[model samples]
Target: MRKTVIVQDSPPSVRLVQVGTEQAGQRIDNFLLRLCKGVPKSHIYKAIRSGEVRVNKGRTSADYRVEEGDTVRIPPIRLPRADEPRPVPPASFPVIYEDDAMLVINKPAGVAVHGGSGVSFGVIEQLRAARPQAPFLELAHRLDRETSGLLIIAKKRKALVALHDMMREGGGRKHYQALVVGDWVNDRQHIRLPLLKWLTAAGERRVRVDAQGKAAHTIITMQKRYGRYSLVGAELRTGRTHQIRVHLASSGHPIVGDDKYGSDEVRAHFARLGLERMFLHAGRLELPHPLSGEPLRLEAPLPPACLKILDYLEQHS
Candidate 1:
């Protein structure tokens, strides 16, 4: 007769782990994300960025690949008491275009491009669920949760990489439509500002115009005026998070219903009118096809909510 011994998995706590043959060649970020059960992706990234995660007694980056026998120092993490309570319901957005190489969707407002910052799941998660048979799918770029319109998804790894390279070299033309609180002074305006991102005391993300920040450029074309507000077309020359929102606010004409950068008074005023969100839309996106080298231009009409607000402005004015 032979006796066998079993080892019990340990509880969640600060611990050191050694990479084994099976774990070798995995990115440190992905390894930790799988090892730390129930830890949010945001928390894992934060720890890596803040130098709390170490490898072999030295600070390591997220992209560092694990080698056999490399000791990883993982900090104590607070896991959710329960696993994601609800499964992501399978859903799909309005498809603007689809092909073997890629897909373009008219992403609705209030849905995050990908989940983080207290969101349990988002477009990518739901899309994967909806198309379980599809082997590869990934976001080519991101859109703010409050902003609506055209979004691109790559159905192949090669397409994803190619799109990234193209965007990096400024190959895409993205245009937005926004309604600002006051009449824009210039019919056409070029805003060149540097934007710095920082966190508030409450740990909220915010962006401001700063001389030392990354260079951001935006071109604004004033569309029409309705008493207290002006609709304008904003062309993004450099795609930065909150670039358009902060740039317009810096110029003294904040986008309407932009609670973070715009006025609280204006938000309340619009909220009372059933117009509860920032009036910003990704109206057009023109990009070269990753595989075919053909130019593809995608457009999404403004949502009904935005149309209702415009109608209200016209009738009330």
Candidate 2:
């Protein structure tokens, strides 16, 4: 008796997903991008434009904010199976603190906070891949790829919203340690400069001091001196893109190993001394608990390499 094989070809089908609280406030286009991995962005937008994507039985624009309990209709999309992108590898970092509502980790320098602008994957993606059972995980805030320290990841949507509100209302205190090239004269000083963001001819993002820009305030305190070099503590009063680096550079004391704003000669000199990355660290953060409103203070010590650089400066001086 010969067994007969059964095969049936079926076309791709539409999918309806209900938005959860954790995914609220995200634009529809971004939501689809993450949901339909490996699909072209142009196709996503085209579907939205052609009224193929719908929310609550009504067509919505790509920029429409998704809310909890909203049903989203996703049209079937074909992805390139022959040249699919590699999967994000599971990764983890040093945990500074962890609770029900949040997870704080010591993010290392050179790893992006999230994948974008040519980066295929970053800390968030890796963490999500590592903890596949996690229901909700989102970044409370972002740190530049070159800066390393206590980075917060919210475990709940309510916690994330509270953290964003706290940041916007200046309810937290953030401090950074930067090793600069020149001897800083001020024992303590407040640098209040407005910063304007612009794109260079190559489309690279850059921030500069301009009157028509957003106000940025940084409180600087000289921590130590090593001949021509000085270690300074920067307290961010108003957080802006590249605020501390731009402020220090504008004051003629660019940070050591800062390629974007520091002197070429200074960076080369520090490179010889074993400082390859930017000498900036987010050392401390003081704020009230996002969910409980209890005051909390978190700190991450400087990396071993940064400490070694300081030791070298001390011995040479």
Candidate 3:
């Protein structure tokens, strides 16, 4: 059974009557070890050190003094579990454009942009697995896992270098489609926000708009609208982590299925409409060819799942 106890005073008191008898003057971490059997000592120490396990309803140092009736709130442990079996590589990921120097793919939603952490395989890995003899294919940029659409991969080192340089020179055009929570009256608007990195309790990276952070800019155009939601097109002038999602959310028009930034009402409404993933897609990309020097433009059609949601909205609206 689980139980909760409130800390009402300093040197927070804890009553672990069922687990073990309290020992006076013991370090908080040591006391927790006796109370929580089979749990790693390091884990307990980390919890105390990180301030997750609090004393007296306040953050405390690991060396915090403890008394007979002090209350301690020991948060449950959360550790990364062992790796699971790898997912099977897709038989074929649709190719939107291909040439000697570079290739563009219409990446499906639920597929990672690149491999990291315990993810042994991602779109880039699968692509290399499919073409073992290809020199090397490097991702020019990245899209979120739940986002689908045009992604460019360079087939050679030279191509990768050229494409990276082109991106830096502002020579590429990227367009995205997103379903936002509210009707936007303005046909076109520019969002200039700065983004800063934050690390969560679980050590996951997140981005937020702060004046002290890196500059980001995006241009939004109203593509169409339903009763309450609007399908908008976004063009990024400066690429930043979750730039569009953060900007639109800050404007009080969060993207559908974006639980991190979207409102609960919007999330529930989209869920009722069968939207399971973020309703965003990288629809179009235009850049100069690495080898041919010709302008290369590619379009990735909306995935079937995205279309289904749009179709439902059309019918209901």
- TM-score, predicted candidate 1 vs. hidden true structure: 0.79
Model 3 residue 40 lDDT? 60
Decide which is better by lDDT, 1 or 2. 2
Estimate TM-scores for all models. Answer: 0.79, 0.90, 0.70
TM-score of candidate 3 to 2 decimals: 0.70
Give the alpha-carbon lDDT of every model.
Answer: 0.85, 0.87, 0.76
| Tens digit of per-residue lDDT, candidate 1, span 135-220 | 56778899989899999998875788788898878898999999998989899999999999999999989999999899999999
Pick by TM-score: which candidate is best? Answer: 2
Estimate, for each residue in 54-154, the C-alpha lDDT of model 3 and write its tens digit. Answer: 66577777676565556677775532233632243544578898888888888888889765545545797677656756545678888888889998988
- By TM-score, the candidates rank as 2, 1, 3
**RMSD of each predicted structure:** 6.7, 6.4, 16.2
Candidate 3 off by > 4 Å: 1-91
After aligning candidate 1 to the native by TM-score, how far in Å is the CA of 207 from where it should be?
A: 0.5
lDDT of 1: 0.85
* Pairs clashing within candidate 2: none
lDDT for predicted candidate 2 compared with the true structure? 0.87
Residue 53 displacement in candidate 2 (angstroms): 3.0
